[model samples]
Target: MDQRVTIEIIDGVADVRLVRADKMNALDNAMFDGLVEAGETLKLNKQVRCVVLSGEGRAFCAGLDASNFGRMAGGGGGGEPENATSRLGPRTHGISNRAQYAVWVWRELEVPVIAAVHGFAYGGGFQLMLGADMRYVTPDARLSILEIKWGLVPDMAGTQLMRHLVREDLVRELTYTGRIFSGAEAQQMGFATRVCDDPRAEALKVAREIAGKSPDAIRAAKRIYNAANYRSAADGLMDESIEQSSLIGSPNQVEAVKANLEQRAPRFAD
Candidate 1:
């Protein structure tokens, strides 16, 4: 079997690809483990400044595999009795359940992530795409909320993510209908950052640009924006102040200024 996920880091950008192309990178049991494991590894790697996520071959992902649903219907979701007992209710990974962590981990990543989506992003796939800081999609790529059609809800942290990405009414409409939408519609609806013929290449270019900046500042900015979704304005302001104070005069920050004045690329520490 092919590796469900693969990571290749270069020039401070980690290229994360879902490699199970035959199944449309579907979320089978092993795929979930692979995704979480990959996310955890990147989280601890200081050398990584930015991440570009994509899938090999056709489709970003087609969401959960049908076999997993069979498992769920049999009174367990993991297909393993121990995990099936309470797959989603238990805090199997930090504050989120195991399944939720597979998607939420991206949000917790300290560095920025850009998703290069093609083919389609459906159900859990859509939620995973939303986890990225920015998303680039092919103009005609098919996408959908998708869970409702399966007699389920978007339970993989999609609810929390959708709140910050689009208006409440739009989220409600998508969640309710689970209708498919094109990438062009997604961009207009504010779900996608850019529509291009080659989303992966665009994502890599952006990731490289981001990787060129001061890593400390980039991380701090991500933290502030992540907090903005759920934090009070007063708390958000305080966090911005603290992050700014820490970044000022830091080695990387000083290097950034010096490099700018010297008209050279900044050499930042990992």
Candidate 2:
């Protein structure tokens, strides 16, 4: 994992950084494994109230490593013939394949995840960012759904996540054109939460604020909001009441109220 990703937790916030600076943090086999492992570890850590994901390099990620394209062009890198078929067909992790899971795991994490995007986020890199609950990007950052350029589709949960953030017509346009857009344009298109001069610092600041909230309430809010996207209005409304019911009178809930009343910071339990 140290080869591709690194994690550090401080003050209830986990900072996850993609560390393949030499390759612009592009996704290779090791990078995929590292990402899944990081997400899994953080998912089980109840002490983690929030997560901030960023890449340490010139770009957030340049999509699949260039070596992958070379392999495809040579038609010699598709792992051992017998294993290739099974790899594509198996739903090894519930509804996702291994590659997809690398990105999907963030969405499944109970705590909110924020992405700090700088430089470029293209193709699979863009999809990975979509898995986050919020994204803060530098104004000059470039992003694109670039698989079409390689005669491929956005297979890394892009179709699923894009629909939620971008309009159908625009998604189609971008996917078909594989055109890069600036972060400012991305914000206008609703793909980014904010555009800043320093996305990493801004993202960390917001992550700290989120960490200060009652963990129970924050987790409940994430669950409820996620349900709103995938569930029917009736089901979503029911979920709201159910989540609140569990939070009401809970230790953290009471502490949240008491803190606000006393104008002091809440000391929540893990």
Give the TM-scores of the predictions, in the order they appear: 0.81, 0.83
Q: How would you encode candidate 2's per-residue C-alpha lDDT over 38-122 as one tens digit per residue?
A: 9999988999999999999899998998666554443332332323444444557656677778887998899999999999999
Candidate 2 local Cα displacement, residue 116, angstroms: 0.2
The residue-level lDDT of candidate 1 at 196 comes to 99
Which numbered prediction scores highest in TM-score against the true structure?
2
| Cα lDDT tens digits for candidate 1, 1-270 | 238999999999999999999999999878889899999999999999999999988999999886655544443322554432233445667656667778879988999999999997999999899889999999999999986554456767777777777999998999879899999999999999999999999999999999999999999999999887745433332332334334434455455545544568768788
lDDT of 1 at 25: 94
TM-score of 1: 0.81
Candidate lDDT (C-alpha), each:
0.80, 0.81
Off by over 4 Å in 2: 80-85, 231-270
RMSD of each: 17.7, 17.9
User: 77, model 1: CA deviation in Å?
Assistant: 5.1
